[model samples]
Target: MHLKIGEVSTIVVSSPEVAKEVLQTNDLNFADRPHQLGADIMCYGSTDIATSPYGGYWKQLRKICTIELLGATRVRSFQSIREEEVSKLITYISANTGSSINLSNKVAAMTSSITSRASFGVKYKDQDAFISLMRKLVTLAEGFIIMDLFPSQKWLHIISGMKPKLEKMHKQFDMIFENIIAEVEKTGGEVETESLLSVLLNIKDHQDLGFPLTMNNIKAVILDMFVAGSETTSAVIDWTMSEILKNPRVMIKAQEEVRKVFGSKGYSDETSLEDLKYLKAVIKETLRLHPPTPLLLPRECRETCDLKGYTIPVGTKVIVNAWAIGRDPEYWSEPEKFVPERFIDHPIDYKGFNMEYIPFGAGRRSCPGISFALPSIELCLAQLLYYYNWDLPSGGIMENIQMTEALGSSSRRASNLILVPISHNHV
Candidate 1:
């Protein structure tokens, strides 16, 4: 698991035991985030919580993120937005029930709309353009991982042209955020309800936070949260659906649970989904196999330390392969199979406490947005199960459905998830 990638000496943690050590036992030693050219350009010099250096400033930003931006209360406040967007998605599916519809595109759009509305509020004057811009930025930001490996080689960044491309997109992102900030400033915070942007603007002048919150800071945080919220949430739903479809037994059992639990209510919502244990298990299984960020954001060793027998020198990059750890045969009974039943009665959960199941990650830098993400992921799957009976398109075989991971920034299926939806009511 130890090797040299380009000029960087790296350690890849693929076992749960080593993962716990890096993420928890010696978390402080590996808490720092490595510099990425794409993140620097997109996140305003890595000032965002996800890319920021581990320190008082980053700690303060994480506090704001957990308490103000994506805390339980904040996540609860966005329920209506999620429900509304998911409803539109259900309707769209119902309308095209007999034909093949691209589930991935619809899911992505719904999540994007929800993220935008939650971040900037209902009046998004340039939503179409902004969403398009965000899509590009997320792809570019994640693309920077490879270029970052050769950080000492400055010429490679220029020769690849990714830096200039990111700079150009960053300008576009800056302008869009400026308009949104201007709108928030004119209103002097929201009159009735506060969006994430308004919340930050209202407290930007507060002196207790330790770091001055600038316009760029606000913009970077927004971009980071948006990318994490929209792209990954949709990807999980896509994978969950794909898994359920490929395994007919899971699909039937999950749909039965969803219908029995929420079918009586005519629609599924965030609150009611808590009772669908089977559906939740299915989602957990999906996350176990297809983590949103398979190789999580790289962590830099702050100081030299002895990990087991090896000397992990200072400044070495460490990557905890959550995907590999989740599928480790020592931990899972049948690592390759799509078995939701394995998690149905298990005590392990996704709260990062159980090292074997750190889907949202673990320790101080763990994703604080879990509360913000789960409701969307749960609601989308519940509604899909409760409303439709999906099938492969004509001539398509379920066993042959491609689960090939996409080559881009995320682990999305290379091809679109085109399925035929049969109305549950009609069935």
Candidate 2:
């Protein structure tokens, strides 16, 4: 689908074949991200990995992410943090058992705490401040500002007063991150486990890649981790739980699988995630139905290319609707249903292959936090399902549960998911 938003030519890819062509075959041609007004103001001029233009700097940052920041070993190092946080969540739910509880808020806070400890060594005193700023950033980044569509109209930003608002938010975030950096520097090599911040600070001076990372670069990367890691993971988990609760059979089967895996030993850490195959499928199905980033970050055409014989000119903004692609009836059977069994026999993985099921996207601009996120999600979901059984707060009535969506770049349930918890011991 091709349309014109002001002076910008926009292409929306809604099919798997075209997605493959754009995200894989001709990925380099559309590798660059479109510059958005909100992203420009929030991402430190697109220095972050998600918004950075395709070039040596992006390659270097991606290399640092894979090799140093979000490597397999580094993700595993945060296991204890995840376990502690999951325990906290379980305890909170237990206290509120037999009454309506806001599962959405609890899960979001849990993920936020886990990301905070893993990234900054300790939760910041002003953690709520960070969350508030991050919510505004996501909302703005996903918004369609007039200045973004009509890049030639530079004066419109000032006239509309959006630029100043963005600048104020950016300054507040800068102060918060700068204080975080200062505190981390004060602790200098004294911590047992290395946070991502420490690792980046260690390499801030190195220029082997022909470009040194500035403080802004480090801060931008931190923002990427927080924004991508906390909210998206929590949303997916919330959606997965909602699906399970709506389908009693699925909830029973998944819980049985989780319990049988741990058997006598209860609530193990991420290491046990490998044994929960059914739960894994549940998550995959949830992501298929509800990808965290539905449209994904927009890609800018870096060079002229012919896709499906459509002469896509240079500088056209490409939008691949992963949400639509996932539900396309051509690939999925009864695509609207939450059927985890579909993945039990299928060989689809989240590594962005096959194009038919890329929740995290594919190719050069694919999300790099997958390694850091998948385990956290699986572990968190496993613990939640293992510890207790969930019921809709609607007095044992299942139909009252609503699956309505709030769509954007980051899609979540339109309303908070409230559920009543029943302990396994009581059951």
Candidate 3:
């Protein structure tokens, strides 16, 4: 559907066919992201990989991300960090067993610790504050930008206090990141394994990076990885668990698969995850039902183009609602159910090739954290299922599980998920 939001032309694609046309067929035409107030303030003036406009600079950033930061070897190197963090999580949860625990808080902490340790060499002292700042930034970035829909009306931003709000928030994040860098500098590269920050700092002054990476640029990338990686993965884990808990059948089957794979092994390893097919399907189904980012970051129309016979004029902001497409009745049978079996024989995956299942998105603008995120998710999910048998608090049943969604750019459960965990081996 096409609508005129203020002065900007907007194209909202809610179906797979239209989404395919915008994301794949005429991808180049809508490759650039619409410049908005929130991204400008939070993304270091649209300099980060996720918000950067499609061009030589963005291309170079993408290359660096794929080849250096998130390369297969680099992603593999973080397994130890993930394993350590998951172990800590198990211990933490183990301590709280028999009591109704807030799994969401624990999950967020787990993801934050792993991401911080991997990205910054060590977990910083201000980790919780940093995560809080990042969440606020995400909220601002997902906010309504008066100037975005009506570019000529820049004054509205100031009038609404959005501009000042974003600027203030940006300053807070900048200071937090500045301290992070200073701490790393003080370490003098003492760490044996280089963190992503260390690697980027090493290359920041390189003459061959096509364009010199400024300090802000490095900070932008760091913020990108930290903010994007932690929250999304945490939300996925939380939602997947919620779905499984809501459907006892799925929980039983997925737990059976997990326990069977890790029987007597005590915990799940990277190798063991490959054999947990049913658990994999459960994750996929969870993603389908609840993608972290429902309305993917909006794209800009670089040029006038036709998408499924609809003429999208130049400068129109295009938004492909991945959430809607995933649940479209035409592509999915009983689109609302938490049925993992739907993927047993289905070829749809998160690799972006399958239009119907793009939880991570599709095309040149798709998320690059797949390699970095999937292992962490699987490991955490496997360990959680393998070690504990979960039940709702105070004899709460599956039907009462709060599935209400918190409204945001990335939606999570509106309330923290509290569950009772029973240790399988009576530890």
Candidate 4:
């Protein structure tokens, strides 16, 4: 279908064939990101992985992300942090048994802590200022700044009084990054522990490959990891809980599987989690219904391209509406229902190869945090179900579960998910 929003004519690629042509066959032509003034500033002149133009710089940064930061080995190395955070979450929920617990807030805290510790060598609990700064950054990223969509409307920043707000956020983020860099420098060439910041600092010091990694570059990378990595993982967990509560049968089935697999094993490890076929299905179903970023990041065309007989001009913003695509009746039966069983014998996955299941997006610009994010979600969900049985507070029925979404870079629960945890033994 061809649709026009303002002067731009968009070719909506809902069909798998069209989607493949746009995202894969002519992917290089659509690899660029649309120009956004606020994004340029926040991303340090669009050097960050998500906003960078399709070129050598993007390739370099993505190499760093995949090989140095979010690579399978690197993500696996953070298992201790994952275990520790999941343990804390379990402890906290157990301590609050019978009380209405805000699972969403707790899960958000868990993800924030893990991401902070892994990326910056500082956990949220250890640094109050950093935690506050992270909260501010998430808020700023979510809020609409006039300059983002309209770069030429420079006066709107002043007229709408958004300039000061943006300036304040920039200053605060700079200070936060500066403090982190300063502390890392204080270590002074010692064989310090490995962290994302430390690795970048080493690259900067060595001037690896003759490309100097500047402070702004480091800050941009850190901001990318912090904002994208933390929020999406947190939001998914919140949605998973909501969906589980909304369908008790699915919840009980998942819980039974987790417990049966890990019985008397004390704590479930990564190996144990991998065998959780049904639990994996539940997570997949949750993502299908409520992808964290409903509309994958917009792609800008670097050259004209033809998709299904429509010409998409250069510089046109291409938005792959994953939310709409996931719910399309043509692709899915009972598209609106919360049905994990749909995936039991299904071959669809979110690794971008499958056009219909691109929750993490597709092609080269797809999210690099998929490996890290999935385990974090699976482990958290597994532990929650294994340790305690949950229910809507006040003996409420499953129908009481609200599916309303809170808008931002990622869509989250409109209201925090409060559920009563009954000990599995009691159940």
Cα RMSD for candidates in order = 2.0, 1.5, 1.3, 2.5
| TM-score (all chains, Cα) for each model | 0.95, 0.97, 0.97, 0.92
lDDT agreement of model 4 with the native? 0.79
Model 4, position 390: C-alpha lDDT score: 79
Model 2: lDDT of residue 177: 86
Model 1: what TM-score? 0.95
Question: Which residue pairs does candidate 2 place in steric collision?
Answer: none
lDDT of 2 by residue, 84-190 (tens): 88888888887887888989888888888888888888777777888878778777766678898899988898777889889999999999888876776688656
Clashing pairs in 4: none
Candidate 4 lDDT by residue in tens digits, 5-83 = 5445455555556667778888888888877656676678877888888888788889888888888888888888888
- Provide the lowest-lDDT 10-residue window in model 1: 137-146
Query: Residue 268 in model 1: shift from native, Å?
Result: 1.9
Q: Give the clash count for each candidate.
A: 0, 0, 0, 0
State the C-alpha lDDT per candidate. Answer: 0.84, 0.86, 0.86, 0.79
Sort order, TM-score high to low: 3, 2, 1, 4
lDDT score for candidate 2 against the true structure: 0.86
